[model samples]
Target: MSKKQEQVLCIDRKTLPASWVTQRTVLSMDFPTFAATCTKAKCSFVRRGIAEEDRQKKQIIPYILLQTADGGMTAAYNRQGNEKRLHDLWSIGIGGHINPEDSAIGTDSFESILKKGMQRELDEELARRVAGDPIEFIGIISEDITPVGSVHMGAVFLIRTQDPEGYLPGDELRSFTWHATQKLSQLNLELWSELSLELINSLNPTL
Candidate 1:
């Protein structure tokens, strides 16, 4: 096995709640299948409406969310020209679309796909921030369907690190910080999606 696959194997799924384990099976069936159906229908509809050239350029994006041991979340902002808009950040998880390469892995199982997707996005986004350091995988904590109108399936992973100090926001992020779990309600930031919040609450219920 590759080093990355070996590290992923070290994650202990037994550490998660029994209820979460059962729920994961149900979610794996519901969301990914629903997402696949939606993608097919959307592509069919778009192909009928647009020109051939435009259709070829379209892309579908996958979704991902990241949780830190501390409760702080990552978000991006649009700045006005040259003003250096600080604090315009929003709260969100790290994830993107599943590329064609991801589809060739021969995994039809949603759980397998979700796990692979998490590793891909984390490595792509956090690599530079860590300066090539390693990230340890924990286990999946929760999963959810995005709003009906949205075109992405969301999965929340419960990740922990002995050293939670190396993370730095990339250019897309205005700023990122680890906030106390209790203080999440006080901030004006967007509320984390239900699954994301559930994972956080599972880890630190008092918050």
Candidate 2:
């Protein structure tokens, strides 16, 4: 929504020197290793859509999947935003880009920057609904086959909330609600959300 470009961090594949090596194991890659190998910069502003293809730029997305202890998970319908293309689609992940503000948090490690960014995004999207909950770092999610997935990489997190009741809708969401594990499969979900749901189901079989 801000017309001013959001200076988000990105890894420009073209800028990496031949001496630097990047592994295919992105999911298992730690943030320190990612930042060390790739050419990082606050260059990829949002909505520069096809620029990613031209520049071979990969944007980082901190995707947070929230769940309560009692097999209840939170999901929302996508609404107006930079990702308005996904409007009406259901998603279990809450996240966005790592902006320049994130860097101000700490540069001690790339992991720390991502953590701060994820927390900021969660707060903005969820209105601090799960502020007191514990968030765990999960693996990454990457799919280069699709145009959207081609330019984006997901750094996934799982947040466990103490409240098992339910959640209220936030500004960015058309609606938010808690669903039982058995009912999750019935709803139509976004492509990335399907993967996220599978991951959650695998970790918590009861859910």
Candidate 3:
């Protein structure tokens, strides 16, 4: 099948918790409560094209923010050379759409599925291993105002990785640099990164 015809994991917006506003980038939420409700909510694997246009369904993306123990973060896939709308903008997270391969849909709970997808994305993009114990859930991000954020939902996570050699990004993650978390505000960050910077600084350990 073509890329657009490929199926992706998605859940109905109504199935989300009351805290999930339709058009806001929410930085705080009860992760347990949200996870419990979502685990039981019915999800459908819809075609990518259709899912992108359906405001009723949310394509779940595990947006991972990688931070080192020394107080730095591995930034995004550089879009400077691309002809896309995000051109010249830097991304602060890595991860992608959850697929049927990551989750068995109705058979597996949302929490389990999300975990698998997060690991799969990390493994696929990085040359090193990302520890699972200290993963921090930042919050949910949504923006119905933008075309890309309109039909999608982001579950932001801050992962503590101890790569002594620093970040060497490739593939989907592309190229990245370990920037001091305190200096992130100086760079041109993507929308999600910009919106969540405050919370990240407050929650994640900084140098």
**TM-score-better candidate, 2 vs 3:** 3
Leading candidate by lDDT: 3
Ten contiguous residues with the weakest lDDT in model 1: 3-12
Error of 1 at 73 (Å): 9.2
lDDT of 2 by residue, 1-207 (tens): 452344666666556443221332134344455555543543334444343554377677898877776557565465455675566777778888887678774444566677788989877876547446677765666665566676666777877777744455568866677766567767777777776766566666666
Please identify model 3 stretches exceeding 4 Å from their true place.
70-74, 80-83, 104-106, 130-133, 164-167, 202-207
Candidate 3 at residue 89, lDDT? 74
**Candidate 2 regions off by >4 Å?**
1-4, 13-55, 105-108, 164-167, 205-207
Candidate 1 residue pairs in backbone clash:
62-97
Task: Write the candidate numbers in order of decreasing lDDT.
Answer: 3, 2, 1
Model 3, residue 63: displacement in angstroms?
Answer: 0.6
Candidate 3 collision pairs: none
Q: After superposition, how far is residue 87 of candidate 3 from its true place, in Å?
A: 3.5
Instruction: Quote the lDDT for 45 in model 3.
Output: 84
Lowest summed lDDT across 10 adjacent residues in model 2 is found at 17-26
